[model samples]
Target: MRNRKNIAVKILAVLAFLVFLIINSRSISNPFRTGISGAASLPLKGLNGAMRAVKKIIPFASLREENRLLRERIDLLNRRIEESGTLSAENRRLKDILGFKNAIPFSSIPAEVIGRDPSNWSNSLIINKGSAHGINDNRAVISMKGLVGRTLEVGRTSSKILLITDPNSKAGVIIQRNRQGGILVGRPDGSCKMIYIALDSDVAPGDRVITAGFGSVFPKGILIGEVAAVGKEPGRLYKYAIVRPAQDMTKLEEVLCIR
Candidate 1:
Protein backbone atom coordinates (compact mmCIF):
# COMPACT_ATOMS: atom_id res chain seq x y z
CA MET A 1 0.00 0.00 0.00
CA ARG A 2 2.85 2.39 0.70
CA ASN A 3 4.37 1.76 -2.76
CA ARG A 4 1.06 2.38 -4.57
CA LYS A 5 0.63 5.70 -2.80
CA ASN A 6 4.08 6.76 -3.85
CA ILE A 7 3.32 6.08 -7.57
CA ALA A 8 0.13 8.18 -7.47
CA VAL A 9 1.94 11.13 -5.92
CA LYS A 10 4.58 10.94 -8.64
CA ILE A 11 1.96 11.07 -11.40
CA LEU A 12 0.27 14.16 -9.87
CA ALA A 13 3.52 16.04 -9.58
CA VAL A 14 4.35 15.41 -13.27
CA LEU A 15 1.00 16.83 -14.48
CA ALA A 16 1.29 20.05 -12.41
CA PHE A 17 4.84 20.63 -13.64
CA LEU A 18 3.74 20.37 -17.28
CA VAL A 19 0.97 23.02 -16.75
CA PHE A 20 3.44 25.41 -15.09
CA LEU A 21 5.87 25.05 -18.01
CA ILE A 22 3.17 25.81 -20.59
CA ILE A 23 2.10 29.07 -18.77
CA ASN A 24 5.69 30.30 -18.25
CA SER A 25 7.27 29.44 -21.63
CA ARG A 26 6.39 31.70 -24.67
CA SER A 27 7.67 29.40 -27.42
CA ILE A 28 5.74 26.42 -26.09
CA SER A 29 2.28 28.24 -25.88
CA ASN A 30 2.57 30.42 -29.03
CA PRO A 31 0.74 28.03 -31.51
CA PHE A 32 -2.29 27.56 -29.18
CA ARG A 33 -2.62 31.36 -28.54
CA THR A 34 -2.44 32.08 -32.28
CA GLY A 35 -5.20 29.50 -33.03
CA ILE A 36 -7.50 31.06 -30.38
CA SER A 37 -6.92 34.63 -31.63
CA GLY A 38 -7.68 33.62 -35.27
CA ALA A 39 -10.97 31.99 -34.25
CA ALA A 40 -12.13 35.11 -32.31
CA SER A 41 -11.16 37.53 -35.09
CA LEU A 42 -13.63 35.98 -37.59
CA PRO A 43 -16.69 37.43 -35.84
CA LEU A 44 -14.94 40.78 -35.16
CA LYS A 45 -14.14 41.25 -38.84
CA GLY A 46 -17.82 40.71 -39.81
CA LEU A 47 -19.00 43.25 -37.23
CA ASN A 48 -16.54 45.87 -38.59
CA GLY A 49 -17.87 45.44 -42.16
CA ALA A 50 -21.46 45.96 -40.98
CA MET A 51 -20.55 49.20 -39.17
CA ARG A 52 -18.86 50.59 -42.32
CA ALA A 53 -21.91 49.81 -44.50
CA VAL A 54 -24.23 51.65 -42.05
CA LYS A 55 -22.01 54.77 -42.17
CA LYS A 56 -22.25 54.86 -46.02
CA ILE A 57 -26.07 54.55 -45.95
CA ILE A 58 -26.42 57.44 -43.46
CA PRO A 59 -24.65 60.00 -45.72
CA PHE A 60 -26.80 59.02 -48.76
CA ALA A 61 -30.01 59.75 -46.83
CA SER A 62 -28.62 63.13 -45.77
CA LEU A 63 -27.83 64.01 -49.39
CA ARG A 64 -31.39 63.18 -50.48
CA GLU A 65 -32.85 65.50 -47.83
CA GLU A 66 -30.51 68.32 -48.88
CA ASN A 67 -31.50 68.00 -52.56
CA ARG A 68 -35.19 68.21 -51.67
CA LEU A 69 -34.66 71.50 -49.84
CA LEU A 70 -32.75 72.99 -52.77
CA ARG A 71 -35.59 72.26 -55.19
CA GLU A 72 -38.14 74.00 -52.97
CA ARG A 73 -36.01 77.15 -52.80
CA ILE A 74 -35.78 77.36 -56.63
CA ASP A 75 -39.57 77.19 -57.05
CA LEU A 76 -40.18 79.99 -54.56
CA LEU A 77 -37.86 82.38 -56.42
CA ASN A 78 -39.61 81.79 -59.77
CA ARG A 79 -43.04 82.93 -58.47
CA ARG A 80 -41.56 86.10 -57.00
CA ILE A 81 -40.06 87.09 -60.37
CA GLU A 82 -43.43 86.75 -62.12
CA GLU A 83 -45.22 88.91 -59.56
CA SER A 84 -42.60 91.65 -59.91
CA GLY A 85 -43.13 91.84 -63.68
CA THR A 86 -46.89 92.26 -63.34
CA LEU A 87 -46.54 95.06 -60.82
CA SER A 88 -44.14 96.96 -63.11
CA ALA A 89 -46.57 96.96 -66.03
CA GLU A 90 -49.41 98.24 -63.84
CA ASN A 91 -47.23 101.11 -62.61
CA ARG A 92 -46.42 102.24 -66.15
CA ARG A 93 -50.07 102.43 -67.18
CA LEU A 94 -51.04 104.46 -64.14
CA LYS A 95 -48.30 106.99 -64.93
CA ASP A 96 -49.70 107.48 -68.43
CA ILE A 97 -53.19 108.14 -67.02
CA LEU A 98 -51.83 110.73 -64.66
CA GLY A 99 -50.06 112.60 -67.46
CA PHE A 100 -53.21 112.70 -69.59
CA LYS A 101 -55.33 113.97 -66.70
CA ASN A 102 -52.93 116.89 -66.31
CA ALA A 103 -53.26 117.87 -69.99
CA ILE A 104 -57.09 118.18 -70.07
CA PRO A 105 -58.61 121.66 -69.72
CA PHE A 106 -61.79 120.80 -67.83
CA SER A 107 -62.50 120.24 -64.14
CA SER A 108 -62.13 116.45 -64.02
CA ILE A 109 -62.81 113.62 -61.59
CA PRO A 110 -60.69 110.48 -61.81
CA ALA A 111 -62.59 107.19 -61.54
CA GLU A 112 -61.81 103.52 -61.96
CA VAL A 113 -63.96 101.27 -64.12
CA ILE A 114 -65.31 98.69 -61.71
CA GLY A 115 -67.68 96.61 -63.79
CA ARG A 116 -69.44 96.26 -67.13
CA ASP A 117 -73.08 95.70 -67.97
CA PRO A 118 -73.34 92.02 -68.85
CA SER A 119 -76.50 92.73 -70.81
CA ASN A 120 -74.78 95.48 -72.81
CA TRP A 121 -71.07 94.94 -72.20
CA SER A 122 -69.71 96.95 -75.11
CA ASN A 123 -72.15 99.86 -74.65
CA SER A 124 -71.92 100.68 -70.95
CA LEU A 125 -69.63 100.55 -67.92
CA ILE A 126 -69.91 101.00 -64.14
CA ILE A 127 -67.51 103.37 -62.42
CA ASN A 128 -66.43 103.40 -58.81
CA LYS A 129 -67.35 107.07 -58.35
CA GLY A 130 -70.94 108.20 -57.92
CA SER A 131 -73.00 111.21 -56.88
CA ALA A 132 -71.25 111.07 -53.54
CA HIS A 133 -68.03 111.83 -55.42
CA GLY A 134 -69.64 114.71 -57.30
CA ILE A 135 -70.54 112.56 -60.31
CA ASN A 136 -73.51 114.01 -62.14
CA ASP A 137 -75.78 112.70 -64.88
CA ASN A 138 -74.97 113.50 -68.52
CA ARG A 139 -71.36 114.46 -67.64
CA ALA A 140 -68.79 113.75 -70.33
CA VAL A 141 -66.34 110.87 -69.64
CA ILE A 142 -62.98 110.65 -71.36
CA SER A 143 -59.88 108.51 -71.08
CA MET A 144 -56.19 109.02 -71.76
CA LYS A 145 -56.63 108.09 -75.41
CA GLY A 146 -59.84 109.97 -76.21
CA LEU A 147 -63.54 110.42 -75.32
CA VAL A 148 -65.23 107.41 -73.74
CA GLY A 149 -68.85 108.35 -73.11
CA ARG A 150 -71.15 110.22 -70.71
CA THR A 151 -72.51 109.50 -67.26
CA LEU A 152 -76.05 108.13 -67.60
CA GLU A 153 -77.16 107.26 -64.05
CA VAL A 154 -75.68 108.39 -60.76
CA GLY A 155 -75.89 106.61 -57.40
CA ARG A 156 -74.44 107.04 -53.94
CA THR A 157 -71.27 104.96 -54.43
CA SER A 158 -71.30 104.12 -58.09
CA SER A 159 -72.48 105.36 -61.48
CA LYS A 160 -73.31 103.94 -64.90
CA ILE A 161 -71.81 105.37 -68.10
CA LEU A 162 -73.31 105.14 -71.58
CA LEU A 163 -70.40 104.49 -73.95
CA ILE A 164 -70.36 106.20 -77.33
CA THR A 165 -70.69 102.75 -78.95
CA ASP A 166 -74.23 102.42 -77.63
CA PRO A 167 -77.03 102.71 -80.18
CA ASN A 168 -78.69 105.55 -78.29
CA SER A 169 -75.57 107.73 -78.14
CA LYS A 170 -75.11 110.69 -80.49
CA ALA A 171 -72.66 113.59 -80.77
CA GLY A 172 -71.95 116.44 -83.13
CA VAL A 173 -68.58 115.75 -84.73
CA ILE A 174 -66.63 117.44 -87.50
CA ILE A 175 -63.94 116.31 -89.88
CA GLN A 176 -60.79 117.70 -88.38
CA ARG A 177 -58.95 118.19 -91.66
CA ASN A 178 -61.67 120.07 -93.59
CA ARG A 179 -64.11 121.22 -90.82
CA GLN A 180 -66.98 119.39 -92.56
CA GLY A 181 -69.90 118.99 -90.15
CA GLY A 182 -71.78 115.76 -89.44
CA ILE A 183 -73.76 113.95 -86.79
CA LEU A 184 -72.01 110.97 -85.11
CA VAL A 185 -74.08 108.02 -83.91
CA GLY A 186 -73.21 104.53 -82.55
CA ARG A 187 -73.88 101.26 -84.37
CA PRO A 188 -74.49 97.75 -83.07
CA ASP A 189 -71.08 96.53 -84.27
CA GLY A 190 -69.26 98.70 -81.72
CA SER A 191 -68.42 101.47 -84.23
CA CYS A 192 -69.67 105.00 -84.96
CA LYS A 193 -71.22 106.56 -88.08
CA MET A 194 -70.79 110.17 -89.18
CA ILE A 195 -73.95 111.05 -91.10
CA TYR A 196 -74.95 114.22 -93.03
CA ILE A 197 -71.55 114.50 -94.76
CA ALA A 198 -72.03 116.03 -98.19
CA LEU A 199 -71.38 113.76 -101.18
CA ASP A 200 -69.09 116.38 -102.69
CA SER A 201 -67.02 116.63 -99.50
CA ASP A 202 -63.45 115.36 -99.83
CA VAL A 203 -63.86 113.17 -96.70
CA ALA A 204 -61.78 110.01 -97.09
CA PRO A 205 -60.32 107.22 -95.01
CA GLY A 206 -57.53 108.29 -92.58
CA ASP A 207 -59.17 111.68 -91.94
CA ARG A 208 -59.45 112.50 -88.23
CA VAL A 209 -62.68 113.52 -86.47
CA ILE A 210 -63.30 115.68 -83.42
CA THR A 211 -66.15 117.05 -81.35
CA ALA A 212 -67.93 120.08 -82.86
CA GLY A 213 -69.01 121.33 -79.36
CA PHE A 214 -72.61 121.74 -80.63
CA GLY A 215 -75.40 122.02 -78.03
CA SER A 216 -72.70 122.16 -75.32
CA VAL A 217 -73.07 118.38 -74.80
CA PHE A 218 -69.37 117.62 -75.36
CA PRO A 219 -66.35 119.89 -75.13
CA LYS A 220 -64.76 121.10 -78.33
CA GLY A 221 -61.69 119.50 -79.95
CA ILE A 222 -61.99 116.14 -78.19
CA LEU A 223 -60.92 113.35 -80.55
CA ILE A 224 -63.75 111.07 -81.64
CA GLY A 225 -62.13 108.75 -84.23
CA GLU A 226 -60.79 108.47 -87.76
CA VAL A 227 -62.78 107.80 -90.91
CA ALA A 228 -62.39 104.15 -91.97
CA ALA A 229 -64.55 104.46 -95.09
CA VAL A 230 -67.14 106.72 -96.71
CA GLY A 231 -70.28 105.88 -98.70
CA LYS A 232 -73.78 107.22 -99.43
CA GLU A 233 -77.16 105.74 -98.60
CA PRO A 234 -78.95 104.71 -101.85
CA GLY A 235 -82.07 106.84 -101.26
CA ARG A 236 -80.52 109.54 -99.09
CA LEU A 237 -78.92 112.81 -100.18
CA TYR A 238 -75.93 112.59 -97.82
CA LYS A 239 -72.74 110.60 -97.34
CA TYR A 240 -71.71 108.64 -94.18
CA ALA A 241 -68.49 107.31 -92.73
CA ILE A 242 -67.51 104.35 -90.54
CA VAL A 243 -65.51 105.78 -87.62
CA ARG A 244 -63.27 103.72 -85.41
CA PRO A 245 -63.16 105.08 -81.88
CA ALA A 246 -59.92 106.77 -80.78
CA GLN A 247 -59.71 104.62 -77.64
CA ASP A 248 -60.10 100.88 -77.31
CA MET A 249 -63.31 100.80 -75.26
CA THR A 250 -63.04 97.08 -74.56
CA LYS A 251 -59.86 97.62 -72.55
CA LEU A 252 -60.87 100.67 -70.54
CA GLU A 253 -59.66 100.64 -66.95
CA GLU A 254 -59.80 104.28 -65.87
CA VAL A 255 -61.61 107.44 -66.99
CA LEU A 256 -61.98 111.14 -66.29
CA CYS A 257 -65.39 112.77 -65.72
CA ILE A 258 -65.72 116.38 -66.94
CA ARG A 259 -67.06 117.84 -63.74
Candidate 2:
Protein backbone atom coordinates (compact mmCIF):
# COMPACT_ATOMS: atom_id res chain seq x y z
CA MET A 1 0.00 0.00 0.00
CA ARG A 2 2.77 2.38 0.90
CA ASN A 3 4.55 1.68 -2.40
CA ARG A 4 1.34 2.29 -4.36
CA LYS A 5 0.81 5.66 -2.63
CA ASN A 6 4.39 6.69 -3.44
CA ILE A 7 3.88 5.77 -7.11
CA ALA A 8 0.62 7.75 -7.26
CA VAL A 9 2.33 10.83 -5.75
CA LYS A 10 5.14 10.49 -8.28
CA ILE A 11 2.64 10.37 -11.17
CA LEU A 12 0.92 13.54 -9.86
CA ALA A 13 4.26 15.30 -9.64
CA VAL A 14 5.11 14.27 -13.23
CA LEU A 15 1.71 15.56 -14.48
CA ALA A 16 2.18 18.91 -12.68
CA PHE A 17 5.67 19.30 -14.17
CA LEU A 18 4.32 18.47 -17.66
CA VAL A 19 1.53 21.05 -17.30
CA PHE A 20 4.07 23.72 -16.24
CA LEU A 21 6.38 22.91 -19.16
CA ILE A 22 3.50 23.09 -21.73
CA ILE A 23 2.40 26.51 -20.31
CA ASN A 24 5.93 27.90 -20.51
CA SER A 25 6.38 26.52 -24.06
CA ARG A 26 3.23 28.38 -25.20
CA SER A 27 4.64 31.62 -23.79
CA ILE A 28 8.15 31.27 -25.42
CA SER A 29 9.62 29.58 -28.58
CA ASN A 30 12.01 27.31 -26.57
CA PRO A 31 12.51 24.01 -28.64
CA PHE A 32 13.45 21.81 -25.58
CA ARG A 33 10.34 22.87 -23.64
CA THR A 34 8.11 22.20 -26.60
CA GLY A 35 9.64 18.69 -27.06
CA ILE A 36 9.08 17.81 -23.36
CA SER A 37 5.51 19.08 -23.59
CA GLY A 38 4.77 16.94 -26.64
CA ALA A 39 6.25 13.81 -24.99
CA ALA A 40 4.17 14.25 -21.78
CA SER A 41 0.92 14.80 -23.76
CA LEU A 42 1.19 11.33 -25.36
CA PRO A 43 1.32 9.44 -21.99
CA LEU A 44 -1.54 11.60 -20.60
CA LYS A 45 -3.78 10.75 -23.56
CA GLY A 46 -3.11 6.99 -23.15
CA LEU A 47 -3.76 7.16 -19.38
CA ASN A 48 -7.11 8.94 -19.88
CA GLY A 49 -8.22 6.30 -22.43
CA ALA A 50 -7.39 3.46 -19.96
CA MET A 51 -9.43 5.17 -17.21
CA ARG A 52 -12.45 5.42 -19.53
CA ALA A 53 -12.21 1.71 -20.37
CA VAL A 54 -12.07 0.82 -16.65
CA LYS A 55 -15.15 2.93 -16.00
CA LYS A 56 -17.11 1.05 -18.71
CA ILE A 57 -15.94 -2.40 -17.51
CA ILE A 58 -17.07 -1.78 -13.90
CA PRO A 59 -20.70 -1.13 -14.88
CA PHE A 60 -20.69 -4.02 -17.32
CA ALA A 61 -19.60 -6.42 -14.59
CA SER A 62 -22.34 -5.15 -12.26
CA LEU A 63 -25.00 -5.63 -14.94
CA ARG A 64 -23.89 -9.24 -15.54
CA GLU A 65 -24.26 -10.02 -11.83
CA GLU A 66 -27.75 -8.51 -11.78
CA ASN A 67 -28.81 -10.67 -14.73
CA ARG A 68 -27.62 -13.80 -12.92
CA LEU A 69 -29.64 -12.89 -9.84
CA LEU A 70 -32.77 -12.26 -11.89
CA ARG A 71 -32.52 -15.65 -13.58
CA GLU A 72 -32.25 -17.36 -10.20
CA ARG A 73 -35.36 -15.55 -8.94
CA ILE A 74 -37.38 -16.62 -11.95
CA ASP A 75 -36.36 -20.22 -11.49
CA LEU A 76 -37.39 -20.12 -7.85
CA LEU A 77 -40.83 -18.75 -8.68
CA ASN A 78 -41.42 -21.41 -11.31
CA ARG A 79 -40.66 -24.22 -8.87
CA ARG A 80 -42.98 -22.75 -6.28
CA ILE A 81 -45.82 -22.53 -8.78
CA GLU A 82 -45.34 -26.14 -9.77
CA GLU A 83 -45.35 -27.25 -6.13
CA SER A 84 -48.55 -25.32 -5.42
CA GLY A 85 -50.33 -26.93 -8.36
CA THR A 86 -49.33 -30.36 -7.18
CA LEU A 87 -50.56 -29.68 -3.67
CA SER A 88 -53.92 -28.44 -4.97
CA ALA A 89 -54.47 -31.55 -7.05
CA GLU A 90 -53.64 -33.80 -4.14
CA ASN A 91 -56.02 -31.88 -1.93
CA ARG A 92 -58.89 -32.39 -4.37
CA ARG A 93 -58.29 -36.13 -4.63
CA LEU A 94 -58.19 -36.58 -0.86
CA LYS A 95 -61.43 -34.64 -0.51
CA ASP A 96 -63.19 -36.94 -2.93
CA ILE A 97 -61.91 -39.98 -1.10
CA LEU A 98 -63.13 -38.55 2.18
CA GLY A 99 -66.57 -37.93 0.73
CA PHE A 100 -66.77 -41.47 -0.54
CA LYS A 101 -65.71 -42.80 2.84
CA ASN A 102 -68.40 -40.84 4.64
CA ALA A 103 -71.12 -41.88 2.19
CA ILE A 104 -70.49 -45.61 2.67
CA PRO A 105 -71.79 -47.45 5.73
CA PHE A 106 -68.99 -50.07 5.84
CA SER A 107 -65.74 -49.54 7.76
CA SER A 108 -62.73 -49.07 5.51
CA ILE A 109 -58.97 -48.52 5.66
CA PRO A 110 -57.47 -46.19 3.14
CA ALA A 111 -54.29 -47.29 1.38
CA GLU A 112 -52.03 -45.93 -1.31
CA VAL A 113 -51.01 -48.08 -4.23
CA ILE A 114 -47.25 -48.46 -4.34
CA GLY A 115 -46.36 -51.15 -6.83
CA ARG A 116 -47.67 -53.33 -9.65
CA ASP A 117 -47.28 -56.78 -11.09
CA PRO A 118 -44.75 -56.59 -13.94
CA SER A 119 -45.84 -59.71 -15.82
CA ASN A 120 -48.09 -59.54 -18.85
CA TRP A 121 -50.20 -62.55 -17.84
CA SER A 122 -51.39 -61.15 -14.48
CA ASN A 123 -52.74 -57.72 -13.54
CA SER A 124 -52.38 -56.73 -9.88
CA LEU A 125 -51.45 -53.86 -7.59
CA ILE A 126 -49.58 -53.61 -4.30
CA ILE A 127 -50.98 -51.40 -1.60
CA ASN A 128 -49.22 -49.85 1.41
CA LYS A 129 -51.46 -51.54 4.01
CA GLY A 130 -51.77 -55.19 4.98
CA SER A 131 -52.40 -57.50 7.93
CA ALA A 132 -51.03 -54.95 10.37
CA HIS A 133 -53.71 -52.55 9.21
CA GLY A 134 -56.53 -55.13 9.38
CA ILE A 135 -56.25 -56.01 5.71
CA ASN A 136 -56.64 -59.70 4.92
CA ASP A 137 -57.02 -62.01 1.97
CA ASN A 138 -60.20 -61.65 -0.08
CA ARG A 139 -60.97 -58.23 1.41
CA ALA A 140 -62.81 -56.05 -1.04
CA VAL A 141 -60.74 -53.18 -2.43
CA ILE A 142 -62.37 -50.17 -3.97
CA SER A 143 -61.87 -46.62 -5.07
CA MET A 144 -64.31 -43.77 -5.18
CA LYS A 145 -65.41 -44.66 -8.72
CA GLY A 146 -66.08 -48.36 -8.15
CA LEU A 147 -64.72 -51.70 -7.05
CA VAL A 148 -60.97 -52.22 -7.53
CA GLY A 149 -60.61 -55.89 -6.59
CA ARG A 150 -59.92 -58.18 -3.66
CA THR A 151 -56.78 -58.37 -1.54
CA LEU A 152 -54.46 -61.37 -1.87
CA GLU A 153 -51.18 -62.47 -0.35
CA VAL A 154 -51.52 -60.03 2.53
CA GLY A 155 -48.24 -59.22 4.27
CA ARG A 156 -47.63 -57.45 7.52
CA THR A 157 -47.45 -53.99 5.99
CA SER A 158 -48.35 -54.48 2.35
CA SER A 159 -50.72 -56.50 0.21
CA LYS A 160 -51.23 -57.51 -3.41
CA ILE A 161 -54.61 -56.88 -5.01
CA LEU A 162 -55.96 -59.13 -7.75
CA LEU A 163 -57.40 -56.60 -10.16
CA ILE A 164 -60.66 -57.45 -11.87
CA THR A 165 -58.79 -57.46 -15.18
CA ASP A 166 -56.66 -60.46 -14.21
CA PRO A 167 -57.65 -63.61 -16.02
CA ASN A 168 -57.93 -65.62 -12.82
CA SER A 169 -60.25 -63.23 -11.00
CA LYS A 170 -63.98 -63.99 -10.65
CA ALA A 171 -66.89 -62.11 -9.15
CA GLY A 172 -70.64 -62.53 -8.94
CA VAL A 173 -72.36 -59.57 -10.49
CA ILE A 174 -75.87 -58.62 -11.61
CA ILE A 175 -77.23 -56.20 -14.14
CA GLN A 176 -78.73 -53.17 -12.45
CA ARG A 177 -81.58 -52.72 -14.96
CA ASN A 178 -82.91 -56.22 -15.48
CA ARG A 179 -81.60 -57.93 -12.34
CA GLN A 180 -80.01 -60.58 -14.48
CA GLY A 181 -77.11 -62.39 -12.79
CA GLY A 182 -73.91 -63.79 -14.26
CA ILE A 183 -70.41 -64.83 -13.36
CA LEU A 184 -67.96 -62.01 -14.09
CA VAL A 185 -64.53 -63.20 -15.11
CA GLY A 186 -61.41 -61.37 -16.26
CA ARG A 187 -60.46 -61.53 -19.91
CA PRO A 188 -57.01 -61.37 -21.50
CA ASP A 189 -57.77 -58.01 -23.07
CA GLY A 190 -57.98 -56.16 -19.73
CA SER A 191 -61.78 -56.31 -19.56
CA CYS A 192 -64.29 -58.42 -17.70
CA LYS A 193 -66.70 -60.88 -19.33
CA MET A 194 -70.00 -61.55 -17.59
CA ILE A 195 -70.74 -65.12 -18.62
CA TYR A 196 -73.52 -67.64 -17.87
CA ILE A 197 -76.26 -65.11 -18.54
CA ALA A 198 -79.56 -66.43 -19.75
CA LEU A 199 -79.71 -65.96 -23.49
CA ASP A 200 -83.27 -64.74 -23.19
CA SER A 201 -82.41 -62.21 -20.42
CA ASP A 202 -82.95 -58.55 -21.25
CA VAL A 203 -79.21 -57.79 -21.21
CA ALA A 204 -77.92 -55.05 -23.47
CA PRO A 205 -74.81 -53.03 -24.17
CA GLY A 206 -75.60 -50.28 -21.66
CA ASP A 207 -76.62 -52.31 -18.62
CA ARG A 208 -74.86 -51.43 -15.37
CA VAL A 209 -73.37 -54.34 -13.42
CA ILE A 210 -72.86 -54.46 -9.72
CA THR A 211 -71.77 -56.92 -7.03
CA ALA A 212 -74.49 -59.54 -6.32
CA GLY A 213 -73.40 -59.96 -2.66
CA PHE A 214 -73.31 -63.71 -3.29
CA GLY A 215 -70.07 -64.15 -1.34
CA SER A 216 -68.78 -63.02 2.02
CA VAL A 217 -66.01 -60.97 0.40
CA PHE A 218 -67.55 -58.29 -1.81
CA PRO A 219 -70.67 -56.57 -0.51
CA LYS A 220 -73.81 -55.85 -2.44
CA GLY A 221 -74.44 -52.62 -4.41
CA ILE A 222 -70.77 -51.97 -5.21
CA LEU A 223 -70.54 -51.03 -8.87
CA ILE A 224 -68.52 -53.37 -11.02
CA GLY A 225 -68.80 -52.27 -14.63
CA GLU A 226 -71.02 -51.58 -17.60
CA VAL A 227 -71.82 -53.94 -20.40
CA ALA A 228 -70.12 -52.96 -23.64
CA ALA A 229 -71.34 -55.80 -25.89
CA VAL A 230 -73.19 -59.09 -25.65
CA GLY A 231 -72.44 -62.35 -27.43
CA LYS A 232 -72.91 -66.07 -27.01
CA GLU A 233 -70.00 -68.19 -25.79
CA PRO A 234 -69.08 -70.72 -28.51
CA GLY A 235 -70.08 -74.33 -27.74
CA ARG A 236 -71.75 -73.16 -24.49
CA LEU A 237 -75.39 -72.65 -23.59
CA TYR A 238 -74.78 -69.19 -22.05
CA LYS A 239 -74.47 -65.65 -23.36
CA TYR A 240 -71.40 -63.51 -22.52
CA ALA A 241 -71.40 -59.75 -22.10
CA ILE A 242 -68.24 -57.67 -22.40
CA VAL A 243 -68.05 -55.31 -19.47
CA ARG A 244 -65.84 -52.28 -18.95
CA PRO A 245 -64.78 -51.70 -15.35
CA ALA A 246 -66.16 -48.62 -13.61
CA GLN A 247 -62.70 -47.65 -12.35
CA ASP A 248 -59.78 -47.24 -14.74
CA MET A 249 -57.37 -49.95 -13.68
CA THR A 250 -54.41 -48.44 -15.48
CA LYS A 251 -54.28 -45.36 -13.23
CA LEU A 252 -55.03 -46.67 -9.76
CA GLU A 253 -53.43 -44.51 -7.07
CA GLU A 254 -55.39 -44.80 -3.83
CA VAL A 255 -57.90 -47.39 -2.61
CA LEU A 256 -60.02 -48.44 0.34
CA CYS A 257 -59.90 -51.87 1.99
CA ILE A 258 -63.29 -52.94 3.41
CA ARG A 259 -63.22 -54.53 6.83
Top-lDDT candidate index:
2
Question: Where does candidate 2 stray beyond 4 Å?
Answer: 1-78
Candidate 2, lDDT over the whole model: 0.83
Ten consecutive residues with minimal summed lDDT in candidate 2?
30-39
Model 1 weakest lDDT span, ten residues long: 33-42
Q: For candidate 2, write residues 1-259 as lDDT tens digits.
A: 9999999999999999988977886456434432443344345445545765676566556555555757877656655665576569778999999989988989999987766677988988877776778997898999998999999767666677999889999999999998899999997678999999997998999899999999999999899989999999688998999999999998888999999
Q: Which stretches of candidate 1 lie over 4 Å from their true place?
A: 1-74, 120-122
The per-residue C-alpha lDDT of model 2 at residue 130 equals 67
RMSD in Å for candidate 1, one decimal? 41.1
